[model samples]
Every structure is written in C-alpha cells, then in structure tokens.
Target chain A: MYRYDEFDHAFVSARVEQFKDQVERRLAGELTEEQFRPLRLMNGVYLQLHAYMLRVAIPYGTLSGRQMHKLAHIARRYDRGYGHFTTRQNIQYNWPALSDMPAVLDELASVEMHALQTSGNCIRNVTADHFAGAAADEAADPRPYAEILRQWSSMHPEFSYLPRKFKIAVTGADRDRAAIQVHDIGLHLKKNEAGELGFAVYIGGGQGRTPMVAKKIRDFLPIEDLLTYTTAIVRVYNLNGRRDNKYKARIKILVHETGTEEITRQVETEWQAIKDTDLKMPQQDVDAIDNYFRMPNLPQRPEGWSQLAAARKADASFARWVDQNVTPHKNPDYGVVTISLKPIGGIPGDATDAQMDLVADIAEKFSNDEIRVSHEQNLVLPHVAIADLRIVYDLLLTDGLATANAGLITDIIACPGLDYCALANARSIPVAQRISERFGKPERQADIGELKIKISGCINACGHHHVGHIGILGVEKKGEELYQISLGGSGDEICTIGDITGRGFSSEEIVDAVETIVDRYLLVRTDKEENFLATYRRLGAAPFKDALYNETANAA
Target chain B: MSVKVLTANRLTDGEAVWLGANGDWLDHIDGALVARHAEAVAALEEAGKAAIKSNLVIDVNVIDVEERGTNLYPLRLRERIRQLGPTIRLDLGKQAEKTSANAA
Candidate 1:
C-alpha cells in the first residue's frame, strides 16, 4: 500500500474541506443543484433515486487491513452497516446523504484515500491486475507506473475536463490479468528483442454503447516515454474526440472514425514533441518502485518421489480448492489465493462486516495483511503459503467466504442494478443469485468448467458483460425487466468483445435461458477442458443461440 | 430497507459528526455553547436539517470508517461567512441602495 506523503495528504485534506463547504452551500440554497452537481461529482458523489451515493476510491484495489477496517467502520456508523465493492475496485455506498459526503470524504483522506476520479468525465482511478506483484509469471510490478500515472492525472489542468471518461490499464505478465486490451490506453510491459524493458501500447479500447478492443498504436515504447506518450494520446483525444454525442465520446469512437493508423500517426506526432520532456521516468523512480514488488522468500518445491504415497492421500477438498481458488505464484510453495467474495446464492463481490474482519485477520496471520480487490469482484490474498491453504479455507468457510468457485460458472460478476442503482434498467444482483442457485451444485459447476458469466444492469458495462465468456445484459421492455445474452467475450491473455446471441428474455425466463446455454456447452464441448468461451469460439453463437432460443422461438 | 447517515465536516475542529446528534441546528440559539455527551443519542433529538432516509437498498451497505470525514467540531463556516457578510456587513447605505433597486 502506498502511504500518503505530505503533498498527497495536503491536497486530499484540502479537497475534503472544499467539498464540505460546497455541500453546505447546496443545502443552504447558496448554490443550486445544477451548480453543485459537477462539484459533487468531482469528489465522487452522486444523487441517485433515493439518496446520495458516495464512491470511495480503493486506488488500484489495494488495501491495508487498517484501511479495510476503516471501511467496515464507515459501513457500520455512517451508511447501512455494509459497503458495496465495485467492478473498478472501488467501494460505493449506495445510499449516503448529500450533506454527510464531505465528512465521509474527510474520513477517506484521513486514511489517504479519496473518491477523486472514481466518477466524472476525467480519468478514473487507474486499475491494474489484482495480482500485480504476486503473480507467478510477473516480469515486473505495474503498480508503480499506475501510481505515477495517478499522480500525473489526478487533476491535470488540460485533461480534467475531457470529452468523456478515460481509463488506462497496465500489466507486466505474459498473461494479461489487467484486461489491458479493453481500456482507453493499455500498456503491456515486455522485454524487447534487445532485452531492454519497454511497453507495448494499445489505444482506443473501451466499453459503452460502442464497444471496441483497442488497436496497437505502438509496437514498442521505451519505459521512459510511458507518461509522455500517454499524455500525447490524451491530448490527441481531447483535440479531436467527438463531444457531440455522449454515447460515442470515448477514444474508441475516435479511433474507429479516423482509422487506427491515423490515430497512431497523430499520437506519434504528438509524442515527438513531448517524449523527451519532463514526463520521462527517471531511472531512480523506476528502480524505487520495482524494489517494492520483489519476490518474497519462498520455500523450494519438495522433491516428490512421484509417490509420497500419492501426496498424503490427496485431500480431495484441498484439490478442489487448489484447482479453483489457488492461482500460479512465482514461488513453488506460494500461491495466489483468491478469497471468494461470492458464496453460493449470495450476491457478487459482497463481504459482510464480520467477513471483512475475518479476512483482515487472516491477511495479518497468514498472508502478511496485504489484500486486493479484483475487478471481477473477489478479494485476493495474492501471496499465501501452500501449507496455510487449509487453514485459510476453513476460516473463510466460517465467514461464508469459502465458495470453491473461482472461475467456474457460479463465479459471476454483476453490478448493483435496480436493487440499488438509479441508472439501471433492471435489477442485476437477484438475477445473478438466481442463476448461481440454479448452477449452485459443485458437481454442476465443475462439469460446466471454466466459464465467465457477467451480468450488467445497463450498458455502462460495470458488470463487464461485454468481456464475459457469457454476458447477460438486463434491459427494460415496456415496464418489465428483460435480459439479452452475448457470448465469446473474454478479458484474459487473449481478449475479445462478446457478440450478442439473439433476442432478449424476460426476468423469469432469463435464468432458464442462461441454463439452456450452459447445458448446450456441456453437450457440445469437445471435452471438459474446453471452456464455454473456447466452445463458443469454435462453434459461433449460431449453435448456442439455436439451442437456447429454438424451442421458445418455435412456440412463438 | 437501509438508512445512510450523512455527516458533515465541522469547521471548528475538522472532524465528522452526525448532524443533529453530534450538534444542534439553532432555530433560536441566542446564547453560549453547550456540550453534549453522546452524539448518537443527540441525533434522535431535534438537532439539524435532514435530507432523506428509509429506502430500498437490497445489497450490502458499506460505511468505510476510514472515510468518516475529519474530526468534526462544528463551527459552521457557512454561517460565519454569512454573519460576517464579507467585510461589509455594516454598510447600510449600500445595502439600502441594493435593497431599493430590488424594490424598484
């Protein structure tokens, strides 16, 4: 976790006070609702249907036990006794008071956190892989660059009032966990042919009304030119991005309109002017950041005689857990343990106050107290010793955090839809719960195998449905809630946007429709190893659509 | 059914407090300052202006304690700015002219 220095501390503290005054003015009628809207939004406050919602930034989804405890406290005292962790790794209090927001912000600043760019048309809280430093194949930690980008973009005078919101993602592993391909600017850290470290830049990827996978603007950019080039891209977007339609204000639209080649040329032209300037990273800065992410002292893998009695008789439960919850860690004995926030039939990405406390305690005891919130709505103990897995799992089980469904069909990603969000056309959480229940059986989920099911209440893509192997988008039909399914999208090493399968289904019919698709995959897949995505890719939406909609269509 | 409390940053001490519970909103406080023991208890009493409450929230509600706003001491900076009237509170001639133009 990055501690706030005086400069960072001072600015956030001052900004909180400024917002307090703004709130008072709005309350006292000194400022109109219109006048206070932007000011409040800048501070990550929004007026929803029922009450004010305060979005507090988690800063790349990294949190100390102390910070998590503080969030738990806020949930208990200020809002309802809980908080909602969002897709962007931020936490949102669905119901906060307009007047109390300043005080909330002040509390956030006290912990060196703020809601600064959680919302607004400006750059958002920069996101990276939840497993940034602790992943097995990491070439380097990407947080340092993310933090640097955060500082540079915090309130940059030029980019503050952009045409629309800008998002940037960075990754340093062979496998892209950061979903770098779907961001406005994606930086993949790689070793060039000459063995020099540099970035492969992709610009114009975004999700909205117009979804796009960013095109490669630069094949190789030296690390020193990272910020300079990023700035150039933003400058280009600001200069030429269409502000006429809110739907198409993203950089992706710009790239699509003026061809990626033209945008690349413009970015190159802009970069030529600033690449050698102050934006370049100092060697010391990079070294300093890299130092924070060095590998932990890990024990060597045991020289198993291939028959230590078949590994102590293989804990069947442990195998299931290891298969799902545990990810590849750099060290043989260490693994990236995903603390499942989704219990069977439970809402996605939600942790109770007690569960949070338990997680904090576990982090302190076995995992060094460093916890991360994933964009997929799961908490991760990025570096957990293999021997300590059972204990962590047992503790998690007691807290309803131990559902052995990490990437399985039951591990869903859903946004707070009509249940909480004023912007949603339908409720997303209940639908997710229904589907999870239908596929809640461990055997059923295991049989289904490696699936990404994402549900979004609206087109904002908060649930990241556009990138799910199976995407469910809930919309309103007349006054009823309807869901549309898309398939073949992914947010991993090889990213692709999902294509819509067919017509929408009603709220009640949606779950059955989803089950229909899952069953189709089970029947048609080459083997269990082939995921829903692979199957969808091998045989396009035609087959899955035919299976899911044929009967209902025939009836119609 | 969930309720979210809206706290404010008190100018006096730069901390957070429940509006009516921690302090009072004076309809007619013409005297000195008084201290209250428990803010949670005081909030139940007639304290300050309220915005909204008692609504639909199905998901888990988070109150990140780290975000409890600064240590509110309650000095009301807005009222102070208004009462002082920006270095020209006693200028009755200008006020009269401004008031008269409005009347006209």
Candidate 2:
C-alpha cells in the first residue's frame, strides 16, 4: 500500500478542484458536449446508455482496507448500490449522475485514489499480477516497477496524446497471472544469472477487433532503463501509429502493419539515443519506491498448520472452498484467498456496497489491511492466515461471496454489454448468466475443471473473449443477438488468440452451444486431470466446432 | 414506414428520456411523440438538435419503432434496453420503477 506523499496529495487535490470547476462550467452551458466529452473521459466519466459511468483506478490491482471502504461509500452514495469490477482491475460505477462526478472524484481523492488515466489516449492504469508480492513463485514484486511507471507516465507530456489508449501490465512470476502477453507493453521482471534485476520487454500485444500476442522485443533490459526503453517504444508508436481510422489506431494494429523486426529495430534505435538520458531510473529512486512495498511483518504462526488441518477435516464445504479459492503464499502459514464475486448465476464481478464494506472489514481484521482486485473479476486477500480462513469464509458466506468455483466454468468474465454500453450490439451479461446457471453445479464445475468463459458484447473485446479458454463473443446478426464461440484462447504465459468455431449461435442456442463444447471436451479429454484448454490444444477446434455446428445443423 | 421517436439522455442526471408531443422530455417512452411520415421524422430530428443545443440532453437520436397494439416498441435491442433498462436486472432501471408504480 503506497501512501500518498504531500506532492501526490496536493496533485490529486488540485485535479479534483480543476474537474469540479470544469463540471460546473459544463452544467452552466459554458462548454458544449463535444468540448466537455474529452474532459469528462479524462476524469474517467463516460455517458452510457441509461446514465454516466465512472471508472476508478486501482493501481496494479492493489487496495488498502480504507480505500475499499471508500469505494463502497461511493457506490452507496453516488451510484446504484453496486459497482462492476472490470477485467483490467478497475471498478466502474454504472449509474452515477454527471452532477455527482465532482463530489465522487473528491471522495476518491480523499482515499489516495483517482480515475485519471483509467480512460483516454494515455497510459491507463498499469495492471500487475493480483498475487504480485505474495505469490510463491515470484522473482521480485512487480508493483514497485508498476508504481515507478505510474509516477513517470501520470500526465507525461510526451505520451499523453498517443494515437489510442495504451495498457501496460507487469508480472514478477513465471505464471503470468497478469495477462502481460495481451497488453500494449508487457514487462516480465526477472533476475539474470548475475543476479541483476531486469525485464523481458513485450510490445504491441492487444485484444480488440484484431487480437495480437505481443512480440518480445528485448531479451533482457536492465531494470535501470525501464522508463527509457518504455518511452522509446511508445515514442515509436506515437509517431507511426495510424490516426486516420480509430479502429486501426492501436499500437497492435501498427505492429501488425509494420513487421515486428522493423518495429523492434525502430524501438532499439530510439532507445539507444535516450539510454543515457534522465529517464534512466537511478538506483536510490528505485529503492525509495521499493521501500513502500516491503513485505508485511508476519511472526511465525506455527499453530495455523494444525488448526487449518482440523478445520478442513470438520467441514467438507470449507475444504472445497479452500481448495478452489486459495493459492499458496510466499509464507507457508499464509495463503492468497480469492473472494468469489461470481456466485451461482450471479453477475460476474459485481459487488454490492454491503459486500464491499464487508470485504474491507474482513481484510482489515483477518488478512493484512491489503485487498486486490484480480483481472479475473475477483477480489483477493493476499495475506490471509490459513488459521483465519474459516472465520473469513463464514463472513463471506453471509453475503453469498463464498462460492467454491474460482477457476471453474461458472467463474466467468462478462462485459457490460448492450445492457449498459451504447457501443454494444448485443447483450453479454444474460449470456454469461445462462451459461453460469447451466453449469452452476459444484460437482459439474469441478468435473469441467479450469474452463474460462469470457463474453464480450461487441468486438471491442472488453470482456477479453479473445483469451478465454472458451470465448463467447456476442454480435448482432440480422437484428438478433448472435454469439460467436472461440475455443483454445488463453491469456497466460503461452498466450494464443482463440479460434472462431463456426457459424454463430442465436441467443437462445448459445447456452446449449457452450454446454455442447464443454460436454465435447469432457468426452474427448484424456482424463479428469486434463483441463478444457489442454484438451482444446490437444485436439484442435474441430471436435468442439463439430459439437456446436453439427448439433445446430441437426436441429435445423 | 416504420415509426420514429426522438430519444436522449438528460444532461443533468443522464436519465434516458423520450421527446413528448408537448415538446417536453418524458422519462418513460410510452408517451413519446411518434413520427410516422418523412415530414414528422424531420420534425422529430429538429427537436432532438434543438434539445441538444439547449443543453438539456446529449446523445440524441431518432430510433425506429413498431406500433404494437397501442404501445410503441423499439426495433433495435439497444434502444429497447435503453427504454426499459438492463434486461438482466429486472429489479433495476425503468422497468422496476414502472412495476412499483403500477403496483402502487
């Protein structure tokens, strides 16, 4: 948890006042919609179907209990009693009034949070692994680097007005939980044989109308040159990326049009010139940022091992939850607990104001005062003691947050589709709901095992359908919602764009189509141990495609 | 010809509203002014522009509707959702308010 220094406090307070003035001017009819839209968007406000939506950033998916409580307060006061946690680890309030935005921002600033780069053609909220510092296999904590990038890129004069919105993700672990491969810039923090910290830099990875796996431009860049190398890549894209078509404006499109080799060469040439500049991070500065993220003091809790074993033995439901939602932590006694936002047939990633408050309370009391919003649209208690798992689980169960299907079929990722988004051609939440209900059984979900079903309303791919193990993209065909299924897509270490199965399914047929794919994988998988992704990779898209289209063909 | 209705989100609160026959914005689309012919459609579009200029609304558009019995139903799903709120959450949006109002 990085506390806001006097500078950060002053800077955020100033921005809030500035936005407040701008809002007043707009409401007073001093600025037209065209003139005010970009300003509103810069403050993370967007006019949606029914009302304005506000996106609040959670830098590197990290939050303190106080900040979580503040988010709950915002939901209760300014919005409908809930907020949607997005795939990029940001929370969006769907029904905030335009008149309430200034006050909402002021409230956020009080909590050391701002919606600044959550939108617009600038470096957006830099995401990192949800389990960054606590994960067992991490090389080093990536948030320190992410924080450094946030400091450097926040209102960076040179990169603010790039061709399109840019996203960067960093992961310290080899597991790639942050989905670094699918971002504009993906930094893999690691140490070389000489024990010097550096990064494996990836460029031009994005998911939209065109999905691209980032090309690894540098084998290893010294940690000191993080900002310099980043500036070089962005500068190259900012200069050459197409501004003619909004669709072709992302760095991913530029990387596609210009060959990877040439783009890498251009970035390298630019880097060579700026390598010795002030952009190079000094060691003391890095250490200063790193100091903010030092691991929390955890005295040995030896009694927790025996207590956890006893608790697991007493309750099968608790055991199931622990098995599904808990992952190993750096400390043997501690575990990273994922609080499932996806209950049976519930909206994915939505938490009620009460739930948010409850989570905040639990985080403060049981876990360290830390909470994380995972990119999978779940919340994380990064340092919950194994001994305290039962108490936390019970509190969560009261609010229907203790679903034992973390990586299962029901743990879906869905975007706010035609339901709320003016840009959406079809509805995504309903499709996700139907699929979750269809496969809501715990035993069934366990049997299916680790299948990600991500849904997007349109090709904007906000739901990240391109990376779902079973991706369902909703598109309007002939005035009806048609869901296009893509199999074998994954946003992981070995990332690949999903293959489109065949003719899309109508809204009525989509759930059955997804079931058919799951059932087909179940039938064809080598064993229960083989997940849907492994089976899909093993036997390409043909079998699942047959199951989807052949069944439709027979029905027709 | 398909009937048309002028719709926009109110600038102050961003509540979805439809242009009424009395030259006023109505939160519910039931009382919206319908345009069945080219001339009326032109009038509706003009009103939308006027509303935008007046700074009363944003994202103004004239959407196609089908006259079903005595009611107007939007042709596009997006517009329908806008009128009725999100389909997924029946407890939310205009649909819930309408339900409660009718019940009352």
Candidate 3:
C-alpha cells in the first residue's frame, strides 16, 4: 500500500481544517444553506433524505489495516454503526451529523484518507481493478498511475469546476475489471511491440440519463505522456463541453455532440502545445513509483497447493467458496480472495463497523495487511496465501462476509435508492433483496451461471444499471413506483447499454420479472458455459422480452 | 384537495424533521402540521423563516399527506420512505427504533 508523505499529509490536514471552519460557520448560522451547500459538497458532505452523508474516498480502492480500522472507528464513533461501499470504490457513512463532519474528516486524514474530489464536477476518485497488483494477467500494477492521477487531479485549479463531474478509470489487466469503457477517460496500461509501456485511451463513455460506451481516442499513448495527454483531454473538454444544460454537461455529451473525429483533433491540438512541457512525467519518477509498488517478498510456498487441495477436499462448502470467491493470483501460492459484502437477503455493499473491523483483522493477518475495495461493492484480500484460504473463509463467515457469491446472482450491485437518496424515485435495495432471497439457493445460483443484475433507483444510473446483463431501473409513473427491466447491458471489454424489453412492473412484480428473465436465459442457453450476457446477445431481446411481457401476461 | 405538511432535514444532524403546529421542528412525522390550500403556503413560508432563523434544516418543502383513519400518512412513496427507514431492512434506522418503541 502507498504511504502518505509529508506534502500529502499537510495538504489533507489543511483541507480538513478548512472544512472544519466551514462546518462551524454553517452551524453558527454565519453561512446560510445556499452558501454552505457547495462548500460541504466539496468535502463529500451531502444532505441526503434522512441524514448528512459523508463519502470518504478509498483511493484506487487500496486500504491498509490501519486505514480500514480507522474507517470502522469512524463508523462507530461519529455516525451510524455501518457504512455503504459505493460502486466508485468509496465508502459512504449514511448518517453523520453535520457538526461532527469536521472531526470525521480529521479521523480520515489521520489515516491518509479524505473526502476531497469524491464528489462535485471535478475528477472524482480514480478507480482501478481491485486485484491490481496480484491479478495473473496484469502487465503492471495500475495503482501507482492512479495515485499519480489522484495527486494531479486533487484540487487542480483549472479543472476544479468543470462542465460536469469527470470520472477516470485505469486498468492494467486485459479483462477490464475497472469497467474502463464506461468512464469519461479510460486508460488501459498496455505495452508496444518493443515492450514499452503506454496507455490505450477510451474517451466519452458514461452512464446516466443518456448512456454511451466510450469510443477509443488513442490506441497507444506513451506512458511518459500520461499527465500531458490527460491535461490535454480535460482542457479540450473544459473549452468545448456543454454548460448551458446540466443534463448534457458530461464529456460523453460533448463527445456525442462534437463527434469523435473533431474532439480528437481538438485534443491533439491541445496536446501539441503542452505535451513536452513541465507536465511530462520524468522516466525516473515513474520508475520510483514502480519501485514503491514492487511485489512484496512473498516467500514461495509450494506446499500451499497440497494444503489447499486437502482443505478443499475436506470441506465441500469451502471447496465451493474456493471455486467462486478465490481468483488466481500472479503467484501460484497466492490467491485473490473476494469478500462478498452481499450476504443473502441482506443489503448489498453495507458493512457494519464490527464486520469492517473483522475484515481489517483478517487482512492484517493473512493478506499482508492490504485490502482492496472493489467497484462491485465487495472487499478484496488482494494477496492471500492459498493455504490460508480456508481460515480466511471461516473468519469471514463469522462476520457474514463469506457468502461465496462473487459473480453469482446474489452478488447484486444496487445504489442507495429511495431508502436514503434524496433524488431516488424508487427503492433499489428492496428489489435487490427480494431477488437475492428468491435466488438465494446455492444450487440454483450455480445452475443459473454468471449473471450481473444492477439496479439504479433513478435515471442517474449510479448503480451502473445501464451496463448490467439484467438492468433494473426504478421510475415513478402515475404516482406509483415502477421498475423498468432492460436486458443485455454489459460493462466489460465489449460495452453496451441494456435495451428496455418492455413496460414497467410494480415493485411487487419486478423481482419475479427478473427471475423470469434469468429462467429464460437458463432454458435457452447453448451450454452452461454460455453466461447471461452471451446468451442474451445470441438470442437477442426477443426471447427475454417474450418471457418478461408476453408469457407473463399470458400467465396472468 | 391535497393535504400537505412542511418537512426538512435538520441542518445540525441532517435528521428528518417536520414543522409542528406550534412552529417547532419535530423528529416525528405524526407531529407535523397538516394544512390545506392557503394554510399550506403560509406554513411553508413559516418553515422557511424557521429554517433561516434557527438554521435548523435544509431543503424545506411541502409534501402531500393523507389522513388514514386517525393517523396522517405521506401520499407519495418517496415521502413515505423518507418518513421511515429503508423498506428492505426493517430492523435498521428510525423505523426499527419506532417499531420497537411502539411495541414496548
């Protein structure tokens, strides 16, 4: 994990002090709500439906044991006894008192964590694949570059107040776990024919009222030019992005309106002016960052294989968890263990303070004290010994974290819908919960195969519902809460927005509708290996649409 | 024909609060002052002034409510959810506390 230096410490502490003063002034009635709203928002404070929500950035989803413990402490001491890990790999405390926000931030700063740039129309927290360093297929760890971007984008004077909130996702792996194709600026760290590091840039992708897959602006951008290239992109966006309408203010809108060819021309023009200036990253600095992210001296444990195999053979459920939750690591002895936050019939992404502390303890013990928060709303022990997998599973099971539902139907991504959000038109968690319960059977989930069900309570698509294989969007019609089902949305290398199959269903009917769609997928699939997205793509929406609307209606 | 009540999240703690008949902000939705037509507008104005003077809440607005027997209920599902905790987790937030308290 990256440690904060003196400059980073000073910058965060000063920011906390500034926000402290702002909160004090607002509480003392010196600053009115109109005056305080933006200031509070800049510090990641949002006035939600029931409480002031404090969103703390978990930079690149990397966490130390100490930092994780502090988060648990904050959840217990300052706000509600739990926190929600969002799709952006950040944790949100749903019930923090406005008066106590400064203190909360102070606690965050102590652990090199902060709420800065987690929100607002600025570069939000840069997200990466949770298994950054450990993933077997990765050419490089993306965290260092993400950290570099975080430093550059933190309070960037020019881009602070942009056309709209900008999001950047970086991934070093080929499978694109970071969902790079759905970001405003997606950087894929790759190598040239000479084995020189560079980025494959995808720009203009976003999910909201209007969802679009990003188009590639640059197939190969030299790694040394990361900063200059990014600056050029933002500068072009700042100059040309829409500001007249908030709805059409994102860079995706600009890319859609201006056409990729024109935008590329503008970015290139801007890049020519500033590519070789002070903005260019020195090769030495890049090497130093690479050194910081050097693979730890994990002594080779060849015995782990036999030990793990023995344990798997001993316990059937442990074997199942190993199959589902444990991902292959670059090291044969090590495995990336995904700790599922989605307990069966429980709220997705929610971790109570006790559960968080337990995870921290486990991370400290077995994962080299390093934890990663996945964008899918789960925690990851990025490097756990294969031999220690069973022990970790047992510990996680005690805290309800070992659901063995990674990539399973129960592992649903849901936004804080009408439950806590001020803008949500419908409740997302209840629908997710009902679906989870309906398909809670392990045998059924395994039979159904890999399915992604994403739910967003509103059109903002915070849940990335647009990219779900089975997307559920909540909308209000005729004073009733209804859910619209969309099929075949994906956020992987092949990015596509789900198509609305039919009319909306009432909250009571949405889960059954989802089951119907999944059941149809299971029936019509070429093989068990054919996942929901592939099956949907092959058959198109006609079959799923028939199952959802026509057959359901006929049955009704 | 819509009965309404003024509500806001308290500025200090961001808890949901309702404008009471005695011009005080109460945590409970049942204590909210119900009004019709002109009274609703005046109540909202009063709520705004209270919000400014006390710095008690932010985003003050009127929500439609209806009388269901002796108790008043918010008409829209959004407002109803705001008044209660998340419908999914019945054991959490203020709704659970309220339920346990009522049971006691």
Off by over 4 Å in 2: A552-556
Which lDDT tens digits does candidate 2 get at residues A275-321? 99998888999999999999899767778889888999999999999
Output the TM-score of candidate 1: 0.82
Off by over 4 Å in 3: A552-556
Judging by DockQ, tell me the better candidate of 2 and 3: 2
CA lDDT, every prediction? 0.75, 0.93, 0.90
Interface RMSD of each: 20.3, 0.7, 1.0
TM-score of each: 0.82, 0.99, 0.98
Docking level of model 1: incorrect
Ranking by DockQ: 2, 3, 1
lDDT by residue for model 1 (B64-98), tens: 11212332221332222222211111232122334
lDDT by residue (tens digit), candidate 1, A1-556? 5777789999998898898888787666677555767998899876543346788888778887877877877777677566777888988875466656777787777778889998888988999889988887877778888888898999899999999999998888879988988999998888888888888899889776678898987888888888899999999999999999988889999999999888889989999998889888998987776665566555554442232224436766656776788887776667789988777888798776777778888887777678898988999998787767767877887867878899888899999876556577777888888888999998888988889899998988889999999898988776577899999999886889999988999988999998888888888999988888888889999878888768778567
- Which model, 1 or 2, shows the larger DockQ? 2
With a 3 Å backbone cut-off (N, CA, C), the pairs that clash in candidate 3 are B11-B56
